[model samples]
Target: MASESLIKTSKYTKYTSYKKISYRSFFVGLLLFIVVSLLFIVVFNAYSGSSPRTDFHEPVNLDSTLLEVVNLKSDARLSSARVSNCTYWDCFNVYRCGRGGHDKITIYIYPLKDYRTESGTPFSQFSKEFYVILDTIRHSKYYTSNPEEACLLVPSIDTLNQHSFSKKHVSQALHSLKYWNDGENHLIFNMLPGSAPNYNSVIDLNTGKAIIAGAGFDTWSFRYGFDISIPVYSHTAEKIDSSQPDQKNYLIISTQLNIPKHYLEVLQNIASSSNDLLLLDKCKMDSDRIDYSKRCEYTTGRMFSYPDVLKEGMFCLVIRSARLTQAVLMDVLASQCIPIVIADSVVMPFNSHVDWNRISLFVPEDNVKNIVKIVHSVSKERRGELYWQLRWVYDKYFASIEKMTLTALEIINEKVFPLAARMYEDWNMPEHIYGPVNPLFLPVTAPKAPGFTAVILTYDRVDSLFTLVKKLVRTSQWHEARGATPAVHPMFTTFIMCDANRS
Candidate 1:
């Protein structure tokens, strides 16, 4: 009986030992599973949030050279104050401030030039140009001091009467000013009649000297005096050989009656006669005046809708209107057309780059007879020389429109974020940070996880889907290079979501 009891006790001891071992094993397995799950969660989150290690390929740094060239070309006359206050950034800021629902600026236009008649008829009609200027100002937020109160301040007779003007036709003259300034709630004034001009005149009110000698002087004059002036640059005419071969001729003339009627008449005659002249006009031609079918070959106008017809010509005649100054001349230069300018003021935009006398033919506005003589004198060889000179000017100052636009945007950004600008400058951030990325030039591969899974969602846009897929492929390759097992073994599976009712 004692032996049997011992056997049972031994069995019980073994069973108890077995139970304890099984419980301990189960707890150890649970703890390991929890640890592994937490570790995985951490790694997944880190991979998802972190920026991939970018391989930076060393680029050719051109900032120093570019800065040196800019400094050399820039006018030495720019004052530190002017540089700080009237920068392109400041201009952009002013534009933004003016457009941000502020008080309107009271632009007081005091004409320094005398009227054509005592009737106060303007010497030139620049209403269109003025309107465009005003419209641009209105759209920009930063220019106005108080946009709510901002308005075109015209000379009031009350202020004029205070200037000791004769009261005989005071009311009539005031009424006329009011009529002329009625559009866009703007105002204008002839400042000479009044003894004391109440408003600030853009031109020297004392000397009666018009600051801008053009049709849009009233508006532009004020803008020049108040707002920061962006130098409207253009290349000057360079001297070229007068006997060059393969010369092309372009005749540029305004067809409006506002210009002397004789100028248009002569141009019309030329258009009918000469094969070289290209007429650009906004006017609708009378069907009966010229046979369109017969003259179609010689004539190119808005009606004809020829693409870049002006650029096709080598020599362009810039007929000067009494009111128009260097505007048309600059246009001809921009078109790479050698200009025969019939106006005063040889000093225009980009005078530093171009030799005006060599490349362009400048005749005084009064000398209409010299137009034909100058045109005939320009030989084909000279035209070739001029073309090369013009091309040089264009490439140096104006070739990359995209780059210029980006530069302008940067200036605007500097104005808006002065603090950030200073910080960036201090850090020596690349000037062309937002330029094209050259994938062929990569620096180093960053460390990454072992495996990756890419899931792309797409809709109806096949092009966008295709682009996304291409980008994913590139990204996978980039990851694979960094030692990560690519999620796409054969190819990445793209899941496209499509709804029958909605795209």
Candidate 2:
């Protein structure tokens, strides 16, 4: 009986010890849970306090009437032609010439033929759209009735088909204009697909005064000099609150299946990996026929009607088509959605004046696969700052017709005025500057030895050689026969290299 009692007491002690361990473990686990929860709360609150908050209006209301602004006045000379408020369509008429503007320089726009056709509509519409801007400037004190009197002649889209697009003809037409020699006028060529470098209609006229647009590069080889690239915007621009939105999605890429296959693949990969929503409107184009009307109508209905589609997204993907830059980028900015540009090389309009880095995100074609990761690296605060930067770009470049026209005018002014001034100075200089020379008193050698030698190669032209020798012998006398010449004339001796093999 004593052995049985001892064994039962030992079993009861073991059961009590097990219960104590379970109670201790439960309390310790509860304490650990509370500590971790407090740490997370502290960290989250600190981050929220330190990070910048974007002041944004929710449920944005867009007003079409708000897009209207006052017309640009002629007397507001020195002011940057940027419009404070104006819709894209009506604003073209408001831009005026600034002080010391070129009243003699006229812009002659050749009416586009076949502009109404399916393929031609985009180019045709683009031509007409830009013409309004040019025409507005034309009426502002500088008007010319005759094409002969005009400083610049801009050919329409259909004109290319009429000319057979031979390089020689285009070159001659642009460089051989009446006032071209005077440096008072130039040719403005819009570099669309049919009008770009690859197109037969396109030719580098080598005219120093020519301005080209839509080409990938800013300056390219052409006649006399290369053409300068100007930013090309869409004729149709959207108006939204210039402020960035409180975005719900990371990116919204609306693309047709016609886009490069590689880009679509990358986008798919990004969509799979992304934590946020990735909106892709695969606007599939059915046929090969270039029908602008169908595409525009469909896009307007599907993509444009929903302005919230843009406002809800942080970045809009702008893929390069035939041209590096597109109207979509302008529209994206107008919608206040920051553009994520994917192109090989994109030259912006007035790029010299605006800093693009602050306004948009540029992703190289090769690095497109890593787009999600790259954008994810940017902090929310940085994105907010980029939004504000885009506002400046929209107000200055996209929404303001005056600003856009002024940028082109500024390029012409830079090229034309300097050459014209040099011509004027040479023409008006006093004869005394050349100094009188007595032709009869010819010397075997110049009074002062020339520091440089002027080598003249000839194939048996004795008469020309004799004339050149005389001019070198009496430098001042040569200027007397001609009008005012370059002040610094070559006074060096000519070493004529005659070909002995010439019969």
Which structure among the candidates has the greatest TM-score? Answer: 2
Q: List ranges where model 1 is wrong by over 4 Å.
A: 1-258, 272-276, 283-302, 345-347, 350-354, 395-503
Per-residue lDDT of 156-215 in model 1, one digit per residue for the tens?
222211133333233333334422322222222221222232322222222111112112
Enumerate clash totals for all models, in the order shown.
37, 4
Tell me the lDDT of model 1 at 93: 23
The global C-alpha lDDT for each of the candidates, from Candidate 1 onward, is 0.40, 0.49
Distance from true location, Cα of 257 in model 1, Å: 9.0
Alpha carbon deviation, residue 93, candidate 1 (Å)? 25
Q: List CA RMSD, all candidates.
A: 28.1, 33.0
Q: Give the TM-score of candidate 2.
A: 0.47
lDDT tens digits, residue span 380-489, model 2: 87787676556556765557555566555544544444443323222222234334455567656653322435678987776677667666745533323665434444
> What's the distance in Å from true for residue 410, model 2?
2.8
- Pairs clashing within candidate 2: 206-222, 206-223, 206-224, 231-349
